[model samples]
Target: MASRLRTGSADMAPPISSGRGPVLWGCALAVLSIALGFGCASTSPARFPSGRALQLNVPYFPQQVGLCGPASLTSVLNYWREETSVEEVARAVYLPQLNGALGIDLTHFAQKKGMQAESYTGSLLDIKDHLARGIPLIAFLNLGGRVFPVGHFVVITGLDEAREEVIVHSGSEANKPIPYQTFIAAWEKTRYWTLQVLPPRPASL
Candidate 1:
């Protein structure tokens, strides 16, 4: 059977014109490298370790137009042992005028729901390590080709070293294996923005 590829939000800006030449591509790559460097510099190596394969039993929530943020959060929260619905999350994270939710909105909403949430920038290796440690991540991906004209949020649930793919719970699909390079390129458009929702720790008394 063909792989089930879930689509993202339709509220993205229009795609870039195809007329741009190699010059634009070169500049974009340079910027991406610099962005990756700056983003990865602050992450501690001890927190993210290399891994071969890692998968977690994360639930799936198919998102409607502009509801990807809430849906992705619902999956992550569910995996963290919280019973949540997309509707409940949407009520807190979704912005009616923008037709979508920002990363900050999602973080704040998660905090209100009693989950510890934080936003950060990291590399693919960092993501792989987090999955290996059983931490599912929510990331902002630029599905817009040529230029980053569109953005979508997804849950990173697993990684396969042999296949060189990252498994994601995207929209309505579970275990979608996106090619490593393909996923990285799209993720780089957003400078590898990630939101981590950690379970609350017991009180230390």
Candidate 2:
């Protein structure tokens, strides 16, 4: 049987443009990096770790607001509601409800950070392209073994450019952020992961 092309349901909406191609995904990844501000920090280089691991003082969800809050979510929604583009839904982390998707709280957290909340449906290749830039990525893991696609939501925070590796954030309150090898082993199974780019909010000053 012929292999079927996997399309990302999250980013692929109607009003399709003619410019659609692999390049479009690249452009999107670039935009995601710009919006996320990977290397835009003012902190001195010496203070920063050699690895791109971001030191998140912000606590984990539910335990701490982490990046933003309810007010932030309102702000993100207010700006994105009118637009046809994706939206970011940010909120404080809460214990999983009956839904069982822990990612829901992260979505809420993204909204609070004033990012457009949307998910992408693509394979690890697409994700690797995005992470190649500064854009952070959220990928699902298999947890079982190396499969075609995975089933866990984790974020790619840093990249080992030399080694062609990535760092993932697995919403673990106790464990430290995950390393590239550990994340890839889990993600290789399903190749199922979500990607999002957080645009900067308007300056308050």
Candidate 3:
């Protein structure tokens, strides 16, 4: 089951307008499990050519601390050829009380905007596979350290098998390379939730 966080009530103040905002704050309802092992999970040699990295030109948007949802969504939508803004997406999916968007909310909003959005849990290979097929995906992560527990969203745009890292557009940081295992650890905190957004399918011939 997906975790939940309560930031007071649905009647809380509306989302802020203007400025890259503060990282979102929320109380997690479930303890995230980080027991997934990464042993023997090296990148597949065949899937990626030796020493060759895959990266896409995903747009970047710096996010206010609590606005990663909208910012990340904006990046993905724009990559799929949709012209949208974080503010517009914030209006559609932002929950002031929760201070962040649920994966389901993001998926719904993308679908409503005529994109093909799907949420699933998969291995790093799956993500690399998507990238190989010219698809980028959104990953839910825990950015907080031992002192703070925070939730974040990022867009995966590339993979470097040589470095065993994945490139992501992370909150104003474009094409940041995170070690594959490190990403898995952070992503595991959110149950490995991933969102795939694709352009609308064409009509049958």
C-alpha RMSD of candidate 1? 10.5
The window of 10 residues in a row where model 2 has the poorest summed lDDT is: 23-32
lDDT-sorted candidate list, best first: 3, 1, 2
TM-score of each: 0.74, 0.40, 0.74
> If candidate 2 were superposed on the true structure by all CA atoms, what would the RMSD be?
13.0
Of 2 and 3, the candidate ranking higher by lDDT: 3
lDDT of 1 at 158: 84
Per-prediction RMSD in angstroms?
Answer: 10.5, 13.0, 12.6
Regions of candidate 1 where Cα sits further than 4 Å from its true position:
1-51, 145-148
User: Which regions in candidate 3 have their CA more than 4 angstroms from the true location?
Assistant: 1-46, 145-148
Candidate 2 segments exceeding 4 Å error: 1-100, 145-152, 161-164, 171-182, 188-191, 200-205
Q: What is candidate 2's CA lDDT for residue 190?
A: 30
- Residue-level lDDT tens digits of model 1 in 1-205: 0122222210122123332211111101111122111112233333332335678898888877788888999999998889999999888767766567767778788888888887666566677557667788988777775333456788898877666788997766888999776787777666567788888868899
Q: Is candidate 1 or candidate 2 better by TM-score?
A: 1
Error of 1 at 79 (Å): 0.9
**Which candidate tops lDDT?**
3
Tens-digit per-residue lDDT, 119-148, candidate 2 = 444443444445444345554455553222
